[model samples]
Target: MRMLAVVALLNLVLVASEAITLEPCALALELTFWRMSGYLGYTLADWLCIVHHVSDFSIQPPLSKTAEKAYGIFGFSNKYWCSDGVQPSRNYCNISCEKFLDDDIQDDVLCARRVLTRNEGAQTWPQWAEKCRGKDLSSYLKDCKL
Candidate 1:
């Protein structure tokens, strides 16, 4: 019974720490994702759009066995949860569900682009999160309004 109480206390402490830790890191890390997502051929909005839809990090840009093996750590379930799950406030959903697990990088990027620009301008990750879906993808990148 004492051990159970200790475990519960530790869990609360760890959970609380994560919230505090993310306050500083979340903006930088997510902003970087927006900046870098373009390198993968995803528009800033494109990446945010797909990240909005994934149910799990394991499924985002779901890599095939060949690609999964190549990405080693990324292949591990929950590894990219920062971008996929851990960051509940941000939806860096760049890769489309259709291509999230796909092995073809180029194809995935194209699919992602389509998803992002499919609507007007380009909705940002924050927009998607606020609206809870893809909608306001503006032409250029937007820093968080906050």
Candidate 2:
């Protein structure tokens, strides 16, 4: 019994150490790109060219994280809270465990889940930032001609 307890405690410490070193998620990629562009003196024309994949500077969306980089596959930081509730640590949340339909954004209350899962795609930044008027994505989504 003593030997088994020691092994279990060792395994627990290993797991905790591994979890703390996970990388920040890809949602931060756009901010990094813009910063690099600014440093390199890139212009609006350069951005257009890059977005359309017409140049070597074109951005590729990063792949989901692998298990070696995180506790799970698709290494997105699962430590996010919805518009409704708090997530305790990572991958665990206090949100209701309710199920709903895919075509369900019309209702205001139902929009919480969509907000939780929606991608910060290039297409929606305009509308999303508009609605998120007082929210904190402001500087990272700073005004830039593109």
Candidate 3:
């Protein structure tokens, strides 16, 4: 009985350690894409599509870090309340997610910019800043020219 208990505890610890390190929202992005793909959806094992394909630069600060990164994935973090609420396809472009996973920073940045543009009339500086993690990414987004 004592040996069994030890083995059970060890297994629990191993499971915990092997858990996915990606943030809840990040994982959601990949999962959403895969699910939206329907029967054609592709996933490397149980992991989401983005996880397997995300480039090194995708995780960089501000862009993929902080609240700004959350905006990229969730679009208006506060509106979604971080991880809950309906996610609309029209507001948040599905194309951008694919481009982001591909490490196409330009398109990814453009996606973010498009959202900002659409929301410009409705969002205040504070809301915009909060969504972008208090950073102005205008220059970064428009530089792509496409």
Candidate 4:
């Protein structure tokens, strides 16, 4: 029946969209790539730890309930870092927030780097100060063979 075929096609499309939207990163692999990309100001471990608390390394993190929604792996804010279309923004990263929600994180990393440079470092993220800072962050990279 055509209706059955249509339902099957819709299910297939849904599955495909879910796969595309939920591409999570593997930690060691991402770390290796990030290091090669020449990210500075924080150790890879520190970055991992910060990301752990911020978005649990989720590429498309859930939108926060607050007025200023944060996005992507680093939870870059719509208000200051990127544009989410819902809020007024400075968009200092000069990028659309939707771009951060995909598996390709090179742009996200670059934006986060800009945030670090302008905001004076990792302390720009309150989660870093509350959870990752001054902690023994060596464990974050322990399993990563990098």
lDDT of every predicted structure (CA atoms): 0.37, 0.30, 0.36, 0.75
**Which residue runs does candidate 3 get wrong by more than 4 Å?**
1-88, 91-96, 121-146
List pairs with backbone clashes in candidate 4.
none
**Candidate 3: which pairs clash?**
none
Query: What are the per-residue Cα lDDT tens digits for candidate 1 across 1-146?
Result: 99999999999978644311112123324545435345434444544443433321223333444312211112222232113333232223343233334333443334334434643323433434454344565532355442
Which digits, one per residue and each the tens of the lDDT, describe model 2 over residues 30-143? Answer: 324434333334332322332222112212222236321111111122243221123333323333222111112122122222333464422222433343334443343344
**TM-score to true structure, per model:** 0.28, 0.20, 0.27, 0.80
- Using lDDT as the measure, name the better of candidate 1 and candidate 3: 1
Comparison by lDDT, 1 against 4, better one: 4
Q: Which portions of model 2 show Cα errors greater than 4 Å?
A: 20-80, 83-113, 116-146
By TM-score, who's the top model here? 4
Better of 1 and 2 by lDDT: 1
Q: lDDT by residue for model 3 over 10-42, one digit each (tens)? A: 999886444233443444354444342222222
Off by over 4 Å in 1: 1-35, 55-136, 139-146
lDDT of 4 by residue, 1-146 (tens): 99999999999978645523322236546756766223655777677777788777666545478879888878888999999788899999999998987878788778887988898688899998989878898777666555
RMSD each, Å = 12.6, 15.5, 13.5, 3.2
Model 2, 145: alpha-carbon shift in Å?
Answer: 30
What are the runs in model 4 whose C-alpha is more than 4 Å off?
1-25, 36-39
| Model 1 TM-score, 2 decimals | 0.28
* TM-score-sorted candidate list, best first: 4, 1, 3, 2
